[model samples]
Target: MQTSKSTTRIISISFFTLALLGCQSAYYGALEKVGIHKRDVMVSRVESANETQLEAKQQFQTALQKFKSVRQFNGGNLENIYETLNDEYETSAALADKINSRINDIESVSDALFEEWEKELSEYTSESLKQKSAQQLTKTKSQYRRLIRAMKNAETSMKPVLNVFKDQVLFLKHNLNAQAIASLKGELNNIESNVATLIKQMNKSIDEANQFIKTMSQ
Candidate 1:
């Protein structure tokens, strides 16, 4: 009886979570009915993506700091250090995935908005208004093109830093000896350089997102 009750509770929680998520699309659709369309969603998503990049930049900085701190280890159990580094890698990878997901979301909304705009253009009675709408669409699409390219470049930049972190963490995990520590020290400079590059790219991408959001809002 207790086991059945626990299973039922878990299932209830899962269903509640799913229901909350389902409400998000419904909320957006509801907004559209009142004329708040996908363009607004795109602007909001770009802002969100910018914030995520800022957070991810800080995370990589923390990971770099942790990597540098490994040099101070004199003679103690290295398990904690390994665990911390692994955790950083995991967190960074998750953040990267978030950035990618945000990019996809922006693309999805942009596609929907563009398609709807094109269809509406065909239904327009005034040729002048249709031309104006087409021009606006082209301008918006150009801005989006620039924004997405910047974001993709930033996303591409994350992989090298992540790879370095993963390599060092896995090395330490298997060896867990003085030699492994020395090996990490040798890779520290390279890691620092990669993290610096990543920070620069993330900042540039954040700037692009900000610019895009501001323009879209206007």
Candidate 2:
């Protein structure tokens, strides 16, 4: 059983690589051949997206701390500060991009699953069972709407935060002096507010993901 599961995992991963490269049809076909369906893909993608959001939350928290540290700068080597801040900005941007990609992946899988579910409803010969399954699909679709909206809200919130980070980094690149640090100090409050809002939205998105995962498990 272990070896069988391991082989399945390898095949699934290989197919996922192909899927990521714009071969989603092939990916779904391969998975279906292995007894894996779009519903399973949705569950897996949601789980991954949840983990990625958690990671982004932590990364943004660190960025907030870095911003705070820069605001309190009474330092000698300001270039070192610029370098560190630049690195944080780059990492945060990369994370924002990753979260967006995950959101897209979740949407893709959800679309395929829900479309298949809606289509398969007609295949049921028994009316009562068909009605029940149809209602379940409706409920699941509603929950997914809430989840994706929250995910998108969080994903969009990252942009303003990234803009602030980028502006500060660019400003410091040309003017690495006390005056530049003073300017950063002025913008620090806005940065804090934006990061706080971003974190709040991420928490909401994460909570939605957890609820969706429960629905999937059921």
Candidate 3:
């Protein structure tokens, strides 16, 4: 079977950096011995993070829609409505948590890869080649910095949005009456606005991720 162009390129990079990872943790050592490398893992994590952000964007929209439904609640099984809203909030919370973990995993692999890259730069015998490698490392790092910052900016909004969601769910659980839902009626605009802003941030982060991937590949 033919290896993907990108996978082959990552494998070729691993061939060079494998030595730089000397006596590293068993986790990395074992993976390196096979076909996977730090760069490969970093790329994988980035893709996972991108997928998560997209999922989160959708979930936020979904949750907002569920919240909007509260304004239209006209004498039904109040318990059922509360349960549905609660489920949406719970799912949104879980997605937010997953996004956080993915970002952390990306950062962990990123540091490892960059450290190995820096060390490998010095191993070049020719000054011209060493300088080129150093320049590439610097450029890649700059690009990565932008990508990580965008991701973090998006994460910053997560908690506030989640807090809003949690508060609504808790309020609904405590008081399943019209008054509790009436309070939610005014929040639809604010909730919609916040989710819209979050989705925009996520969109930017996804763009940055794609750019970073291209920078690394180059």
What are the per-residue Cα lDDT tens digits for candidate 2 across 123-168?
9999999999999998998999999999999999999999999999
Order the candidates by lDDT, highest first: 2, 1, 3
Clashes of 2: 0
lDDT string for model 3 (1-218, tens) is 98999999999899867754454556676899998999888888898999898888898888888889887778888788889888998999998889889988888888888988898987889999999889888887888889999999899877778888888788978998888788778777878878888888889999999888776665
Show where candidate 2 strays beyond 4 Å: 1-22
Candidate 1's displacement at residue 95, Å, is 0.6
Better candidate number, 2 or 3, judged by lDDT: 2
Residue pairs with backbone atoms closer than 3 Å in model 2 (clashes): none
Rank by TM-score, descending? 2, 3, 1
Regions more than 4 Å wrong, model 3: 1-24
Model 1 worst lDDT window (10 residues): 20-29
lDDT at 178, model 1: 94
| Every candidate's lDDT | 0.89, 0.91, 0.85
RMSD to native, candidate 2? 9.7
Report the C-alpha displacement of residue 199, candidate 2, in angstroms.
Answer: 0.7
